[model samples]
Target: MITSAVRQALRTRGDEPAVLCLIGDLGPDRAELAALRLRGNDRRVDLDAHGMGRPVTVEGIGGEGEPSSVGLVVIAADGLTDLRRAVTVTTQLPPTAHLLVVVRHVPAHLGPLVPAPPTIDEWNDLHELRVRRFGNRGWACELCFPGGMSVAEALAAVVHGPRGRRRGPGVGVLGGLSGTQAALWRPGDVAARGVTATGPVEIDRVTPVSDLVLRLDDGGGLPFWEDVEVPAVDRLATDATVAPEVRSPEARLRVYGTDPVSRVAPVDERFVNPIGFTKKTKGPLGELVEVEGRVVVRDETCVRIRPTPDGTVTENDLERVRHLRGVRVGWPEHGDTATVRIVAALAAGGVPLIGDPAPMWAAGLGAPLAELIAGGAEDVLLDPLRREEHSIRLRRAALRTHGVRTRWRSLAAEAGLPVPPETRVSVVLCTRRPELVGFALAQIARQRHVRFEAVLALHGFSADLPEVDAAVAEFRATGIPLVVHEAEGEKVFGAVMNDAVDRASGTVIAKWDDDDWYGPEHLADLMLARAYSGADVVGISQNFTYLEELDLTVWRGYRSEVPSPAIVGSTILADRVVIEDVGGFRPRPRAIDSQFLLAVTRAGCRVYRTHGFGYLLRRAGGGHTWNVDLGYFLRNHTEQWIGWRPSVLLEGVPAPFGAQADRHIDHPGEHVERL
Candidate 1:
């Protein structure tokens, strides 16, 4: 990948120059390899692998003291901090040099540093690799390497082979389906089934000419098949209204879900419009207004309702409404397809508020949907304080229950087709602080909606201690699997983590810190983000922190719900396969998390950062591996409270031991000396 990227950069420059300045941290071996490749092409390469803020100068090609202008510059950043330093190098480069910045992992939030958008070549959790270029015209796809194909073979094919379309099975649709609805069907499955027509297709008539015939229904009554005395069609119904003759165990209704694109799109924090209603507007009781000849409505909060036309909500439509805090949706009445689609679109897009979900009980989504409904749009939806809180909850629920793949998998199972097994996670907790063992185990025990086992690795301590033994017994009583590994003399944090990972038998592995607090749905939310984003690793930002010394809580303004190069080390969750692919964590004493992320990104795997409302990082005096001081967090915090005030997602979670007493500190200034 690096060789190809360098070749492309050189080709784009149009001409060779005196010197090619190589900067940033690409490790010594990679730097040498890159230099060797360039030398074979007869290019003069100058390496600066440590990112020492060196000036790019043509030393060998120019006069002894005269500063020579550079021709091509390539920066290789290892992590987010290194990426920022690499961006600064562009300012120091001469006007003649054409700069190309290459990072092993590209973070979602690049900030306002880059002059233009950088092109990205990403490999998803599936083996497929896609190259995307961003310019004034937005993102354009260059190429896609299919799954199970080696990268070298794909590159060679792109260079020499003819670009011919591969043929597959044919599918014929009898009725019109919205783009959102059409996206639910996998391309391969649709091609395999010769006819995927809407309900009422005669089975005997179509099955003779086609390999497979699938009849799709929109939850409406099967009026077309009402006259047929013995309907022998293989059906796919969205609701519980199939014909009695065909109501076998394999013919049950499977509730379909929202489009996948909406779930992966970045959430826009700046809310220009407060309330939005798209495609359907039957039950949103509000004052009507006309703006630019378009229908608009204003509720009691004076928040205007931006309504889209009564049609299918496209991908572009979902992207546009990403900034809206609340989306007003009508009840999914029986057989009301428009309302159903609207609800799903809003839910998957992470819209904070949705409404009138009383009628969704018949649609197989009663409890989760009811939790997100707005009782009164003006009262509940307009509350600014709870909007972000609601968004976290709604998006988490959508990932666990309403993903398109999950819906399709359910349908495939009911039809007696093959389906993938459910995902199981292994939570790895490594700690030297034996005092915090019970606190950590309690948090792990509260997690829900995921099949997970906890692997506790005690560094420089024994699990036989009274406090550790008692916590282990309490945690085991919850019926969850637990494995304890004692590293009595091991000092390296990274090696200890690797030992814990080796003991884990789960498909997915999550790292947990002993001193932090996590909500019940933390692991479930990470799984959901991974499913929709197709990212190899998924974790949360360190948005919330509790300063144990000063008895204060700080909330940082880090951007969540996007793809970032790095996340908080404690909240990291990744597939076990990717972990092994990257050769596990580096066997170092410090910066283990950052180094592991760099390795993953260098291997062309994506790292995604989801919402951090459920996690609370505790910063005690100074014994932690991450040795940043309390004052640093205080300086970067967007908001602060006197005591431990976590987000609403952590409301039911019990406070850490002795945290309840810190709530009585009245004023934080009294504990200023402790910092």
Candidate 2:
């Protein structure tokens, strides 16, 4: 992937200089550099003289102003007649840019004054190998910074005794995570060794886009010079942390962590967790055998990880609980259980966690480790260390087992339909926006689960809705039955949908909103979830919406991994009898879906949630959203809705297409009806 990325970078650079070798004031032969410049785009600049510890002045040759920033910096060690000038130049480059240091031999002169990088094993031979690959037996050996370190750090690596915070706690954390490549601050000069260490260190800055910033000391202004190398799988937002507490089966376990009971669980009445958390919600794994299975799971019981009689701990224990959605476990009775050993090993490696109990507590496994995870006086007890540990090993295994990369074709097999497409399902699509009717119709035409008819209900008359009627006429060629309903006067959104449902002659009536988009397998997923989960009304309660003004795709409901009494809205597929039981949708200008779902729940209708199977609610500044507070709506603290990945209820289904932010749908292809 890295090689391909580098190649793509070269390709995209076009006519720009691909390799700029700075050889003192003149830099590597300008003529050679010019030829090295990647194809077509003619963009080049020069840095005549560079100061090692100081900044270098840049001259922009093109119309572009003195460059705001640059992407790469290359320095030749042999041309370094002045060490101070070299130090100044590298420090001035962007923190994010890549740096390359070319050398004929290891420059021992700069080692003591600057931080040393990881030792280069057989540096001469390695250079010879690369030089051969480039077919340029040039007398220079080049050193590229590993893992995209900041240019500042790369320059520091050229010098003497500890150039950074050599004594602080961050050193340890950085040491543990880097494995054998950790160049840390120890007594004199820490060498790259596999230091196994773990503890809770404080996070100085949660810079997700770049560095894993840490606070090395309790005093204000902790060392900013060093950073921890967070594994890609272990990285997570500051707010997202795991809180696990062990409890006796009879201990009356409420919601775990800082999650509110109302939001996470049905609260004896409601469902769904507050944002930034999860509650103990369980459902079938959806691993169907031969035929699809209709499974119902309301067991909110947290999986208990108890100590063995001998109080032994092992990797096997962690694996045992790996598949569980939520878990509760006490500290292993044996003082040196596998959990304790893992934490100790990580601490020994210099990777200390950041949280309430502090690094020392975890370093020693002092008292009960469960206390660390259960320390939620205000909110969730965020144990990032424990969560990351699982991701580093366990989650990757699960991902590898499912070798199939997600795509439309692979997803088709995953969508395993419980019943064939010939089974009729009615989609009551209500729309007030004539301009976007084509968009809605386009999605309807693309649904992979085909045994459905479209009941296109336009709120206004045909005279005012020329665009809608035009789309309708265009779709007439498609063989799929599309029953058009043109309301004569202004009608409420709920009334329009309810009237369509009344007129539709299918056993299943699916509610659909015009602005919302869906995956081709959406209806199929819903129908399967309803069939297998034994749900009276099944749909994606985890409503992922696209915020048009913000240009962001977001999920509103809290519990996205389990079932809850969520306002599933348009994606809901209700049995005709269930709709009648709820007395149909109450007609109002707004909050119609919410009102109807509430009625359904109150009337004893079973609402099952599905995963991200493409029920994208397109939220804009105008329209029905006027009824709610935008801030609260965006943050999603407003309500508790229960739902999980559609794959949980329905077996063998990949994620819905538009569920990912980048895979967002914006097309309304030819609306010609399929015959």
Candidate 3:
């Protein structure tokens, strides 16, 4: 029966699997049984019996050491007699190895052996009687789990107990083995249930759960799906601090007064009125920085006034005192009353007591002759406006100063089109200055290893510049392609640049000015920087310096060598397409680049900087530096501010200096929208 069972088990294990029949004998019969099992079945089965004596020894079980090649182990009733021997053998069976045992029909020993009594139907072989133990053994036997255990409780006990058979000492056995057969599964047949867990608990609309697989009628399964109520939080306030740092330490106090000589009250403790001036003040100097003050006490020849709480006064206050009526001349006119005492109490601050001399002070003073002034000064009164003109004349004589100059041509250049290409570019030259045209075009024609191109835009050209015309012809002779064009009339600078951009033909387009020059390797290094950064635009710094008066000589010496930051605005390297998509530059006549730059940044393009010589922007008579027309700039500023519109500036470039950038304007796209 043992031989039949071993053979049956070997046959069940289809392959040429090693079958270790760990019985108490290893004699020739055991070898023959192994060979017979091997021959009778399609699989090769080797029977390695543990002992050859009448009784199975504990030491015999030691041979079962992790059956590496063995598929199963057959433990006969005789071989399992020694508890220690059973353990040793079972322990040696590798985690994956299976065990099957058979026992004789010994009624007394079999009753307590198994948890269940085997029924007649449980035995497939009718010749072999079926037997089972009684009571719940706190674990389900193989027979109780024919369709697999519905719950983990019963199996847990058997897998956790001291011996493979004893689940709990006092637990009631669910079933028992009768006086004939033994239990079936091998040591390796038992599997461990995996414990799985989800990650951190997320308090959101959907929470995570594990092990629950929902099956649809179509045989598909949803491993995880969650539905839960989630309270909404304020998005703006979520990560924001309720109280931010106050940028201005003092409150701004606006005290309105129309009169030029109005006595303004002092400001509160934490604040100070730093200035006093007319609302619609004219003239550049006063419109921005001019100030005025009032005098409350005046004597016949001087003025006595309370000093500011700070105990200090500025030159402007002294000038105000000097301009006051009935006030006599004092070395320092705004602070203290010592000068007033010298002029006496008869006159408030020191002047002729009879006449309102404020008007007289405004007129030419001292040794200058005014025919009517030969009589008593009080009798000769002048209108304030006329007095102001005279005061200006006197001040001019007293201070020995000249008036400010009005006309200025900060930056001037020729405007033209930009020729864009489709290949990796070695250089991009933008210019209008006739002097610089030669140097920039020559560099492009002479560049090696990388392809080169030029975009010469002539702005404000009255007549064709002879020098620039010659340079263009020279560049053409060298076989280097050049695109020369002029700016569209009646558009802002931003618009002018946008028009020039239509002609760029290179993948990596660089910026150039009519007065700017470049190093030989500038284009090569800029292209490399573009590749490494994976950016749409890269900027190089150009050193700024004042040039000579001549456009040509002035243009040649200016250099824009970038500083610490590699990225910048005015001078950038990028693809031409980026410029076209951003609607080009705005038509703002003043501060044209400023508006366009803002637009490019909003578009979401990467801006980087390259470490190399970029270009030289001449800081000479180049009228481009200062936006001479304020009205045009304000118009553009208002357009951007009100509509929140972006300027059609070049995109994909960084404006490193930001608000401080003067002549050039570019924008790095922040977010790009796919068309």
Q: Which candidate ranks first by lDDT, i.e. highest?
A: 1
* Window of ten residues with lowest summed lDDT in model 2: 265-274
TM-score, cand. 1 vs. native: 0.59
TM-score of each: 0.59, 0.36, 0.28
What are the Cα lDDT values of the candidates? 0.51, 0.39, 0.32
What lDDT tens digits, residue by residue, belong to model 3 across residues 1-675? 545655666677544243343332322435555556353222221122221111222222225562233344444433222221233223323221334444322222122233222233533322222233322321112222222121222222222221112121110111111000011101111221111111122322554321111111101111222222211100011001112342122211221122211111111100000111111112111100101432233433443333222111221232233333322232233422222212121121112222223233222222221121222242121332222223322322221111000000000000111122224552444344445555556545554435767766665552156666666666777777777877645555655666667676665566655444344445654554343233456675322222323221111111111112334345566666666656776776655444545555667655544432234333343357443332322221211122111211111112121122222322112321111
Q: What's the residue-level lDDT of 180 in candidate 3?
A: 6
Task: Give the top-scoring candidate (TM-score).
Answer: 1
Rank order (by lDDT, best first): 1, 2, 3
Cand. 3 Cα-lDDT: 0.32
Model 2 lDDT, full chain set: 0.39
- Candidate 1: misplaced stretches above 4 Å? 1-192, 196-214, 217-312, 330-335, 354-365, 375-385, 412-420, 654-675
Give the per-residue lDDT of model 2 (tens digit) for 387-407. 323222221121111111111
Alpha-carbon RMSD to native, per candidate: 18.2, 25.4, 40.5
